[model samples]
Target: MGFTGMEAQKDEDLVTDLTGIHHVGSYARIDNLINFENNSASQLLLVGQRRITIDDVHDSDNGPLRVSISAIETPLFDKKNQMIKAYSNEIVAALREIVKMNPLFKEHMQYYSQRIDIHNPYILADFAASVTTGDGEELQSVLEELDCESRLKKALELLTKEMELSRVQQSIKEQVEEKQRILEFIAVSKLLGKVQGRIICLVGPPGVGKTSIGKSIARSLNREFYRFSVGGLSDVAEIKGHRRTYIGAMPGKVIQCLKTTQSSNPLILIDEIDKLGRGYQGDPASALLELLDPSQNTSFVDHYLDVPVDLSRVLFVCTANVTDTIPGPLLDRMELIRLSGYDGPEKVAIANQYLVPKALEKSGLKEGSEHVPPTLSLTEGSIEDLVKRYCREAGVRNLEQHIEKIFRKVALEVVENLANTSHEDQHNFTISPDKLHKYVGQPRFTSYVYLERMYDKLQPGVVMGLAWTAMGGSSLYIETTTVQTKGGKGSLVTTGQMGSVMEESTKIAHTFARHKLEQVLEPDNAFFEADLHLHVPEGATPKDGPSAGCTMVTALLSLALDK
Candidate 1:
């Protein structure tokens, strides 16, 4: 032991925190650990001369250890001791499995692999734990365990779980790749014949990849892609083309789409067809009926094309946020498919398979040759954290934004480090939960309904409800609070930007609560004199659905019960 003295008062606090079971080790303590002179703390510069153990810890009159130092037993290792030898071999084998699962550990593991004393069970256990640093609690458990067998057993269990998890991740990656191949094949072999001269309308919530699917279809067919939005378009002349008699005549959008693509069989995507409206020029929706009709379009004549033009080879696809607004006759001409947003597991898989690699390339994180690990990476826990916390969306638009945000920060750090150093070290940032906030800012928000369910602590007059929208399903909370009026007369008040449907639902809920209170509560309870104000949060967002009816009734009953 060197530099034997620890700060007199703070020594016991540090003693309690010591987790290791080592019989011989040393650490120094300083009373007021910081210093004002030269703005540096005092250093405990100990020179190790020899190893020793404290045989006795006598408290004397000083209230601290005034001990005698002695030499203790050294662990003996014999290769012939099969029990000790077996545990030692198992630890090494488990460490190798862990290394195989995690590529990031491979580079640093070579040194530890060669340095570990395989013959000594205790030494092997310690070496394996250091290489596979599982977690604080697990590491501390291994540190305090004096038995070599127990230490090796614990380390093996931790490594086994890690290896199994890695296998699942690898399997998911392969499945995603195979799915991509199958989709491409289906596009070429079947979709070409299915929608040869027909139109397709993708109906889904915004950001649900409707537009991207259109582009993907075009790529799969090896055709040029062109898109134009007909939102609020209301002129028939735009579809049939302007007559040559007009001073400035032009071809219709269909002819222009064919001309710009230069390929007669190119894909044409019409965006927001449901948004078309009436205008003085003419009804564009009516003209679209003529263009999309299979019998008329084969030799379709445009006013400006001035001749029969064949449009049967030009494939048309359309997209809309909702299908209801599309004219019934127009919608009948196309095949429609709905794309709901992804679930949690699906989002995580997509992030790993498509989003992560794309973000790495887009942010230039793998730009230089020496960026050795290739791309900035996310730890498994971090990927789960990002999905659960930062990105709770119907679409991955916000998820991609957050991922891009993380990479942009990593890019800055890499550039700054390179400028400051000799460029000898590679900058590969592997993000985990602890370091997540350093890259992306705080998560935008925690969903109110999610928090309510997680805590499972609901106050009276609060009820959960399910809702359906063009986007998808969502859960909302309906809260009813009672207010006593001055005149002993009560009128119900409703908030939450509710449409007429919700307003009527609220009134129905109020009437039911009144009848229920009459049956349950005492006849003269003060609750009858109080006005009830019902509200749903996020009032700026309009909500109107019959799905919330049952919930409103539940909330009103809770308020009446005052439970």
Candidate 2:
């Protein structure tokens, strides 16, 4: 028979299962009744007793029968050891996965696993129960659990959740650190005031590499590039986005540029600032002051976003044909870099190095195989003649176009020759100085086209003068004529769409002529008796500046004295 007992000083402290020791209710079965075997003289115990005294179990005959327990407890230490080992191993495995998920816990993994191994289920349960959320609620619901297995399962569940949370926290930390570093970089850049505060304005004529320079700067800095034209942008909403209340509301060009490049520090090219227009809507030039200003762009607020965006790190590059039309306030914020047009030698060099190869490739005339000989070539003299005779503007855009045109014609000729002649008899094509006109049609300019003709048909009232424009310098012919009037008093008149500056120059020339030539001219001469009409050729072109004063005086004096 199995027997179990525990000693307690008070009956109130006793708690045990009495199902095996109790007799079956309402039945007297030999196995169900506890057979004392007459060992105890007193048998006063009854079934289902709620309370009992120690004296009730005392034997009167044998004086507390010698109850020597053969074996008090049969310890299944192996099973208990197995259970403890299994629980500790599972806990270690979970903790190891935790370390793998987040390496920040790796350093303490061994120490934590050892502590868990020493205390086993008890310590493991405590660890899980201690894992409370920010609001002080337990992470796992294992409270009041007396079974070790149940507690271990709850602890594992809690560990898995905590590990996931640790990974999430780690990711968030890294992102925050990266954002912090970027902010610090921006702050340092702003403080240094090198490229951050600077806004560059590329001032030059058309096709002078202003936009190309902006692209090169972006490439060199390894920053994203974006370009937009403000040439005729009149609405302020184009710079700063439209409000959401509008039908087709959107962010301004600055915001759009940032979005298009997907970078906060992209190189933005605001093209044709000088051509920015002002209409009834609003002034875009005035709006650009905030976008291009370093001191205020840090907190640039868009009407659509209605939130300040930090644009201190963005590099702004603006282009303009000239600065004269740009608003003063907007112009004051930019640093001007002048890009002059290419000269003759410069054009020739550019054509040889860049334009020729590009044109050849585009026309499918360049040899594809490196071992193959070049099929098309241009002599330096021919290119020099092309530059002097045609494409005489300051920029190489027209030069490049002319080269491409030549390559196209050469390509056609080469194809024709190849179709007719045998491969062995084929020869390289070259355009010498003499053959330039055959392909390019005819020379647009000549060295003595104007001056030679002027000298050949020299007249008393006509003279040659030089004038400078954005396209480069050119010669102009000033002509003067006298129209006899009924009265001797005379008036001076000028034509040729001259600007105020040129008109003033004409007046100055007239005054100088009257003072110096009053004695030289006779009283009855047209200088005193007729209206002097001064005219410059190319009447459609609007000419300005006082540089032509001397030429005007020379023409007027020649007409008055018929010199």
Candidate 3:
């Protein structure tokens, strides 16, 4: 071996400079021993002033040889080894598949593949060292493998496990980042008052929990809730407040609401906002626009106090039966959330879960009481029957009222029968579908009753129609027939307290029917010559809108063609 910068250095100091390269020939007494099983290398070499170029070495000492410095270099496998040539392509292809599964590992995979030594039967173990950098006992077993193909298999298995762990870690990092981004977005939105500051308007039929939802929001936020109705509010001063100079001057409902709640940021529910009245005093609906607008409400000025009240933090929820009567400008500032009425199944569920229990409590009918006998049993079928037969309104207000009425009667009957009847005889008072009529009187409504009553009337000149009213949806019939009047030429007469829109609809229907039936009718037919009367049933009730125009046309056509 030839060494540079070796100026009579101590043997211990030479150990520090043992990392440099050197040339060692066959003649040199160099012994570098590496135990593949131990997973460690031992190198012993003798450095001299001159390089040794002899082809053979002659050593006489057989005793243990000691060296102060050491280094080891493992040799590559023979290129002519047939196994390496046969298996190289298969291992490369498998590595390519792994790289495709993890694109980020491509550079590392290439570097490790280039470092593989064909002489090392544990070429896979050497590659895995670069890949995993782990000295695990499992990897030690792979290092001890001596077979070319078997070691390659073990190395690939180790690489697969490391890749799976890497993928899982990467996935966890991405998920945490996504959650952080969402949290930041929500924080930013709330900080800027972009979503939370808008005034929300709940539009639905009566008793649909609009006001209740407002209270729920307040309770959830740990804020106070205040509700007031403006159904017939007319004076602008009621909202903006009367001036301090006026008699009995006071702050507007907004200030009153804040004072009642005793919090600046309390939730204020404005009920019946759609029914806000407009009179000579001024429009209350118009006054509400300034109070509801998030941008303007920050510095709301009340006339009575004549001071700007910071109402930006206050949450406003307005409730209305419908949005038609609400002022357009005021409505523009609100975010509308429409709640539809509960159907039969929903009402039955609510009655069973909440309404029935509330009624029992209110009517002094204690479930499981000696006089009441067992828990107040209201089956789902019976509730469904009640919902179908007694209450058909859009809202549950009527249903709740009917349940309360039934409970009141049951309470009364139980008290009277407490003295006269035995415990077994009390079963007569147990509420069921058949006995429902006895408590609430006859069902206020019956399913398809109107349609059944009008079945015979639905003839050649009559057509069934649907109409919506303040109460609920109902069936209507349009009847068309010839009306004889002396010297009266063909004319149209509409009854049923028809409004201007309905009158216009009747005229349009008559004109359209005449045009459509022109070819079908006889040339000498008196269908158009005689006066036609279009009469809607329930003549005393006022009706409007063009919804019934199709029914009117159908009835007119039926009468004209006698079909």
Candidate 4:
């Protein structure tokens, strides 16, 4: 035990010696002899001159160890001197904010700070270093620096860093308070798991009013509405947030939503969760795992905010074209609600109730003080014609746009003849079924849905085929016939905007037909001697896929057997 204690004491003594000595050959004055003439416990002013270096250390017989030193001179060029002056001025400016934070330093610094020489930039730097609250080692290192410019630069760096760290600390404090307030609100309401079932996911095709429905829901609940689009969002930072190390980094969508809505509990519509793209930065889907997952999200932490944000109070409603496109784990956490595209009745109702009135008000097409004077009404027959000729889509977006167009045209006429007693023309500006063609040009399309079909009667080489798609089911015709014959080297031809998979299926079907034909054909029959062409009609639709495999095979067999 005694030996260990002796060794520890020796190590401590060696460290003290090493800490005082640096490459600059300087000494740290433990007690100032020159400044002893005036001893005021309130403050001690140590004026800096030049950097002094120790030459030798000697032990006195009765008193204490003494050091002999020499002054080291360093001459600065005009550029470096100016740089030092600039940096020192910045340090002085930064100290104002720093001193306000530290009272002990402020009280003593207030007196000498005002009288300090700003002209001697090196002296100003020393003034700040001496009065500032910092690590003793760092202060001594600055005191040891001989180069005036380097010393000032290092002091400025330290001051700037200290101020920045203080700001971040303050920011974190405010965020913590904000988080606490939100948590308290959540605690009182305690709506964590209770509202997850109310999490409505509106999944349907684009322009189907999924986003509009989310806004309506918010309005009904008397809550603030905010929409966050995660479509094509590849960066995980977009969901989580970039770290503070990144310049101009900020909180992710969830935290940003809270800031934007200005309420702890706002209805947030997360749009296009399915269309999130993956990239090298990170998988946004994985980041959203913690965001949407209710159990894990009670304490959601964004990298930029670096705090556990309580997203539980903020209701999240997601919208997507298809649920299958959403990540499995993410989809599993929410209540999936499938919203089909509007039918003809639903589309017409939406246009009549919501769209026409809104567009008329916006276009200033009114007779009285109120902008919506019910002056313009789209006749039901005209609406039906518009639906059939202009738009027959599953969504009402196109229908709404067309309605907007009619109101816009009428608005222009109202403005043009405002001075000309326009009551006659404005009141009779109703859009009738016949007048729709006058305003929007001739009927863009007939009330006929195009379908792929073969000739009325079954031909020897043609077969009626059926296919399914995202748009719906459709029937098509596959036609095959003999095209060329030479040297018995039969070649097959395929056409009709077929993709790679479709082309390969046609080849497979053709091979299967030949195999079957060879078994039934007499050895002398020239059934496989001619080149044949296989074609699918309605080339405009760009048909492709293995869905047509069976139809292609049946057509080949019909051609081979001449049935």
Span of ten consecutive residues with least summed lDDT in model 1: 13-22
Q: Which candidate do you rate higher for TM-score, 1 or 4?
A: 1
> Model 1: per-residue lDDT, tens digit, 292-318?
776678788899978999877777778
Using TM-score as the measure, the top candidate is 3
Give each model's whole-structure lDDT.
0.71, 0.70, 0.69, 0.70
Query: Could you tell me which residue pairs clash in candidate 1?
Result: none
| Residue 196 lDDT (model 2) | 59
Residues 1-563, model 4: lDDT tens digits: 00011223443533223233442433233334333334543333334445666567676665533656677676554655567667866887888887665445577677776766656766667776766545555776776676778878778766766665454333323435332432343334444434453345667666776786666546534469998888999999988988999898988887888888899878889888889999999999998878777677889988987878888767778888776678888887766655556666677777888887777777776446433335467899888778777876667878888888888887776555564664645556667998987677777675434432346588888988886544334577889888765456567888888889899998888888788888988755665778888888878778777877788878878877888
Worst 10 residues of 4 by lDDT: 1-10
Kindly report which residue stretches of model 2 are placed more than 4 angstroms away from their true locations once superposed. Answer: 1-198, 245-248, 367-375, 421-428, 448-453, 456-461, 481-488, 499-501, 519-527, 545-547, 558-563
lDDT of 1 at 541: 88
- Which is better, 2 or 3, measured by lDDT? 2
lDDT of 2 at 486: 58
Clashes (candidate 4): 0
Which lDDT tens digits does candidate 2 get at residues 159-247?
76666556544433443533243334335664775455457787877876778767755654457999999988889998889999999
Task: State in Å the error of residue 555, model 2.
Answer: 2.9
